[model samples]
Target: MIYLDYVSTTPLNQEVNHMYQSLLNDYFANADSLYSLGLKTSALMEKSRELTAQLLHVLPEEIIFTSGASESNSAAIKGCAFQYQNRGKHIITTAVEHSSVYQSCIQLRDVFGFEVDFISVDASGNLDLKQLEEAIRPDTILITMMYVNNEVGMVFPIEKVYQMIQKINPKIKLHVDMVQALGKMPIDLTHVDLASFSAHKIYGLKGSGVLYKKTSTSLVPLINGGQQEHQLRGGTSNTATHTMFAKTLRLALENLEQKYQYVTSLNHYIREQLTQIPDIVINTPSEHVSPYILNFSCVGYKPEVILHALEMYECYVSTKSTCSSHKSDISRTLQAMGIREDIAKSAIRISFSHHTTQDELDEFLFYLKKTLKTIKKQR
Candidate 1:
């Protein structure tokens, strides 16, 4: 199968998989136990934390491992809101965030009585900085935004936004959902207060994730039980999976530049070929977007129909974020960008991994054109 849904999740790296298997067999003790085997497992888990912190340029104490990005996002947004609500009850975020971030904010608004200001994005899914600046009030205690848009792969100006927020209110916390940016780009945590990451996105184990909370930052425990994850999250540490994630992250960063160059070229090739197809409208902006994802609309065709047609040819693609793929509604990212409902409903997202080959892309393009022709004839 020609897998084009890397944004949803990546295949496990064989090396990382091997590490996971080895660790699971050797270090099966509970990390929190006081026994010798448990102590060794706990030490290994701390080592994994240190490695992840090194990658993000943060301290070992700042990295909190979780199930995945969804849990990390929930912990960052909800935990911060609950812990700092005494300081302020208002939070700011963008409209194009992942479902996890968006829903977390919604829960704060509906259940916790916090006021949320959702900034708008342009047609290309770029946030309006001016609106963001204007939305910050004295009661704005936190700002949650995504580093890279999942649907279109638009990279948000995170550093700039953080700096701007600091200038306006140094006390306000900034939380970034960096699930899509982890291995695809260089991540600097110098200005960020908090950020979330997922291991599966970088060819690591599915159950591992990371939340970077600056040393000075504070959050209420999402899962309260034991003293795991520096008291930010509670439960028995998934020692094996977290260790495997750190190894995968290190490997991914080692080849970051090389993979970027290769993927950029592949993206350009797809963009050029897609332009030649009639009724195809590229939704992803030519600039200010990650080379890993390309979202476009087939004017007369519905996304579900196109998805099934491509499936027949063993070309797997997607309509939107994998978390929201089961929903029949239009793309929230497209709607937030002010795209027409018809175009939004017809949008298809094609994401790439470093392992995707030129020949695979060529095959996909052939099937895509054939599918379009077949659909047209049926009409």
Candidate 2:
């Protein structure tokens, strides 16, 4: 099968799998137990945290391991709101964020009565800085945005946003979802207050993730059954997965620059070929976008039609974020960029990994064009 859905999830890297297996079989003791075996396991976990922290350039204590990015996003947003509510109840975010961030913000506004301002993006999927500045208030507590958009690969200007926040409200916290950006590009979280990452997004195991909370930043615990992750999250830990986080990150970042340049050529090849097709419009912008993902629309055809037709040839792609791809809604991400309804409703997302090849892309295109022709005849 030609799999082109890396943004949704990636197959586990063999090296990371080996690390996980070693820990699972020999070091299975609970990290929190007071016994000698548990103490040794706890040391291993701390070492993992230290290495992950060093790689990400943060304090070891700052890394809070959780189930995945969705839980991390919810914990960061809600925990911040609850812990620091006395400071403010207002928050700011972009309209094109992943569903995890968008829905978390929605929960704050709809269920908890917090004021949320979702800043809209321009047609090219870039945020309006002036509009963002106007939206910030004395009560605005946090601004959560994604580092790289999963659907269209738009890279939000988090540095500029951080600078703007310092000028407007020095107290406001900045949180970013780094799932799509973590393995695709280098990250510096020095100026960021909180960030979320999923191991699965970077070719590691699923059901494991990290939330980087600055040492000085205070967040009320999101989970409270016991004292783990500095009372931030509760429950028995997934020891094997958590301990291998550092290796997972290390392998993903290896040769990243070379991998990126090679993938750019692949993306360029597909983008050129897709533009020549009838009734197809590219949704991903050419500028300030990650080369790992490309999105386009087959205007007259529903996404499900094209997807099913392509599946007959064992080709695979996706629509928008996988969190909401199963639903029939038009892409809110494309809609926020002011794309036409015909295009937005028919958007298809194709993501790539360094493992993707030119031959796979060529075969994918052959099947894709054949599917479009079949649909045209049906019409």
Steric overlap count per candidate: 0, 0
Worst 10 residues of 2 by lDDT: 370-379
lDDT tens per residue, model 1, 295-373: 9999878788889999998999998888998999987889999998777878999999888999999999999998998
- Where does candidate 2 stray beyond 4 Å? 376-379
User: lDDT scores for all predictions?
Assistant: 0.90, 0.91
Models, CA RMSD each = 1.2, 1.2
- Assess every candidate by TM-score: 0.98, 0.98
* Model 1, residue 35: C-alpha shift (Å): 1.8
- Which regions of candidate 1 fall more than 4 Å away from where they truly are? 376-379
Residue 137, candidate 1: alpha-carbon lDDT: 92
Candidate 1 residue pairs in clash (backbone atoms < 3 Å): none
Q: Global lDDT for candidate 2?
A: 0.91
